[model samples]
Target: MAASTCVRAGEISPGHDSFTGSPSTADRLTGSVAVDGQRRHGGSSRDVRRGRPTLVCPCLPVVDGLSSGRLDQDEGVSSFRKGDHGEPDSVRFEAAGLRWLGEAPGGVAVAEVLSEGPGWLETARVHPGGATAAAAEQLGRALARTHAAGAPHLGCPPAGWTGDGFMGRAQLPLRGTPGPDSWGEFYAADRVLPYLAGAVANGAIDTAGERTVRRCADRLATGELDAPQPRLVTRPAARLHGDLWSGNVLWGERDGIVAATLIDPAAHGGHAESDLAQLGVFGAPHLDRVVAAYDEISPLAPGWRERVGLHQLHMLIVHAALFGGSYGRQTVRTAARYA
Candidate 1:
């Protein structure tokens, strides 16, 4: 799971197709779809198979065997995907997370889940044409609302998602302390320190780099970095799109309105600012507008901007552990800033 990267749902093109006993020209029109059977549904490829035209859907590349694309039906073109793991529990966890986030106040706009079963999830397709400043601003505002929705504690998974969550393809353990003194502590213990250890064991981070990270991690644990009032925004655990990089923010227009729709969430309860900081990880377009809008709705704490790199350390280290390259160096640099 570490090697897998999450896809940005907005950039994908959508179409729809269904599998039923046979190969049809309609099936060919829907690229990237796979079906178990070979028999055609209506007629042979040569026949028009009159009455209704078969819908061809587009599929997105997900980690392992999970495939996402569009499905055609009278209701509308729905976003659909099939999971690699044939377990209902796996699909249920993600589906539950998406639903929880979508239902939150100023909630996120997510692809609607139509139906899900073992090894498969079907959803309403989102066609993101491009990112716009207006959309970015709206995203920021809504994100604040999402965070304000709150959680039981930091590191907690979305309601109903009891199983371990994921970051990309890597399994991420989701557990929270009864009540923590500071966000830094939980982040260090659950997010940073564990990944650092794994990176060191895999030779991704050399001994010296590992030592440096440990120092920063120790500081995190001691709560030295914790500045409760000014530096951090104290709030109930806010709902977080655990992975909020730009790619996950899908941009699209509907009814002449453009907006950012979130996809591929690693949703959880955590500091709202952490989700905001993640936007800068890979550089989100119109980030300034997004931040400004968010701040207007839910004012951020003083010096929150400076903490961007601090929050980003978790993802950097995760990348280092998984990709094993210059990412390790980048992680250390970010950690050193706060250390």
Candidate 2:
């Protein structure tokens, strides 16, 4: 999602007027327009014919494919995401994830993918709404259904995608083949250690911090932290929204009522508790309700609460690698108990 202040349904955010159009009045719009620093191709054919400006955001960074903007077309309002040349497959990866997650029988509502092309992808826009308790509960139930969709193995990527995916701006390791037999092993190798090494190389964490995190990683690799699989999960892996931070969950209007719409996934196959733990990482609204609702449906493994920090270590280390500061310190502190 874009870093813009939340606005009510049908209202536009300040300083983003260039991309605005009346959802009810706009005609079918099409054609590619350069984003970020790319050269403008005059304007979309619809823009030229209708005497409107080409849709573009000048404030976005060149490498930020996740930066989003609104597009009002004849069908309705949609969210347009530009692709990053630096991360060529990011757009396709996200598209694949959305489709895969959406296929779950009773899964969480995802933004509908309207169209996609080489350098851009568009999806039905979710209008911002309050995170009501009812919405939170629905999100919980839906998320459990999504996890129950299952994947082929612990480290498998989305069904059709074979390459590595992106977690925010960082590389998210993935495997198409059957991965390690245990979730602990896959989590250590694909999730924690890679980001830990990056954090150390970037000076985000000191030697002591490295040792502490490595100790936790060693325990994870050895399956010391592995827990019994949830009763509902019959497969070796549960589908996961690899990055389930608060920002990625949009509480918005859906079907005339407020509901959660998941976006910007680093989707993969892993332990289900990781997704539940991530909701608490940055303080999601009504998080307790969400977790309770989820537990009602799927019944998490015993002692799952005690393992929250264990799962959260992956996200913390990724943040440490990307933005060295308190995140590094936080990672080390979180790893100490498990170490």
Candidate 3:
């Protein structure tokens, strides 16, 4: 169904109460694209037509054919507003319960050929620096606000996720029910351990790193790793930009942390700490305050900081798989931090 919708790329409004009671008018979804055609609410059909306008994304051409309107809209809906990681997985907006709430799928990509200046990765340039560090905190806090909005209605429902990461190709985890009963088992077996093996097979990884990952997996699997229980959560689950890193953090207007709008997301119902850990690894701006603010609203475990290094290993491995240069070095260093 979603694959068909992605091909169509038709204007849609979820009929569900996704945005029904939100105070923001933007969150109030009144109608959807009619099965027959475009539907108008109180305003004239002409009014609807008048208000509707086309959006132009610089990277559309490469994406349109790629998505073919066949991507998972349900999963896309889950990723609407997140602390964007640096991928062009931004998608069509869906409804939510917070500031200018909406959902987005990676499938909205459309195609046209052009030797564009820069690219969808403009956010990467906004690295946290002297002044930007303060902004990074603000950005982190704003991300917490986004968290306060409410959880996503849709979920990935897929077990495997492998769009891109460290070396060139690697599979990560997504949200949904797994056959495994515990989040710990699911995370270690399905998430980190798989990538450990994949990285080795791809030649981007080595024996030492592989052994460490396996060891970490063993400890985590056998209850050797110290992890906090009664994890941070939100209804419908946590709204993570999933793949947050330093490059993904953006500077919004001169200074002050603006938005942690997410890009490439392995989005799902999982730990909010995972997102924070990635933010920290890349030296993302405003590291200290981000966690403090988040704790004010959604407190993390007492020892969340200690566990962050463990979580950082996962993302470092991802980067090693994607970039394969210094990132691989970083991956080895970070993984060894535990071993």
Candidate 4:
């Protein structure tokens, strides 16, 4: 009855461990999916047998005993996710993000939000499947369309959402006042600086590393590292899955066909390359196909590959702030390049 064990299809009852399968290579690489009774949740150790409520799947965690499972009503299976304690707006924020992202015509697939309340959100369960080149390619093109949907401004939150959101339990600062025009300024101010400060405050970063990151941030704020606006977009800001790591890109079957479904987004308005760069942070499967197909739809600005490290700095600092281990060192190493 451990939460890490996969629930049997159409069953929500406790104390059943019917699923005995092993996680795939990609799942193992991401450390997000597991069939055994122990696994990591967002890089943090989680053991449901020790007083936490049993989760229906390893990817989704719930609080206050609000576990996800089959409804047994013939409407098919659904996954429930509840907000962590003290984060009241988390579930609502996620619901708004999913709705906004799903609005794009021909965009990447997102989990359908079935219902939501003050502390919990429910979504249709996407059955797990193997990743293929074709699926990755289609995801790439669809992702381009999603980014083309655009946002009102860089660093803006999803439409209809107010206040700040989260990026995997870390406070994700959203746009409150607008002044910076270019993506570089917005990214430096909203994306990198906030998490950098948090990492420092947590003692995850040393004085030397802090100084190095600040230098990088200064250059970024001066608009020195900004890339040209992507073709076919009027706005500078793209609708980004703010936390687009491989763990968030769920490869699964929908409508009897294999495809990618995006989940657990810290969705916002930002540079498109930021999303693309995150795919590389943890080695997304068939990433080359994803990017190539995306370029076919909306050609990326030149020199994008060269700027991957620049774009990836934010997520690294976030990891530093939250996990406080080698992530701090990694953040400094990446920032040293731009510094």
Off by over 4 Å in 4: 1-73
What would the per-residue lDDT of candidate 4 be over residues 57-99, giving only the tens digit for each residue?
A: 4434443333333322134444444444456577678788888
lDDT (10s digit) by residue, model 3, range 1-339: 111111111111132111101122111111222232221111111121222122211222221221111111232211111111233232211111111222322111111111112212221111122334444455555555444443432233312332322211344444343344344555576557665654665666688767766666776666555444323344444455555654443343325433343333445544566667766443434456665666765566676655665666666566555445444455555455455
Q: What is the lDDT of candidate 1?
A: 0.63
Instruction: Looking at model 4, report the run of 10 residues with the lowest lDDT sum.
Output: 17-26
lDDT of 4: 0.69
Q: Rate the local accuracy (lDDT) of all candidates.
A: 0.63, 0.70, 0.40, 0.69
Evaluate model 4: give its TM-score. Answer: 0.81
lDDT of 4 at 36: 36
Best-to-worst ranking by lDDT: 2, 4, 1, 3
The residue-by-residue lDDT of candidate 1 on 1-339, one tens digit each, is 011222222111112111111112122212311232111111111111111234564654444545544456676553445454633455566677789889886666876778887766676655545677788788878888877777777878888777578775556668744556577788888789878876777777888888789888888888876643222234557778887765566676677888877766788887786777676555567777887788887887776756766777776777677666656776776677677
Regions of candidate 1 where Cα sits further than 4 Å from its true position: 1-63, 86-90, 176-179, 227-235
Candidate 3 has its poorest 10 consecutive residues by lDDT at 1-10
Better lDDT candidate (2, 3): 2
Judging by TM-score, tell me the better candidate of 2 and 3: 2
TM-score computed on alpha carbons, candidate 2:
0.81
Q: Tell how far residue 60 is off in model 3, in angstroms.
A: 10
Q: Predict model 3's lDDT versus the native.
A: 0.40
Which regions of candidate 3 are displaced past 4 Å?
1-138, 145-169, 178-181, 229-237, 254-260, 337-339
lDDT: which candidate is best?
2
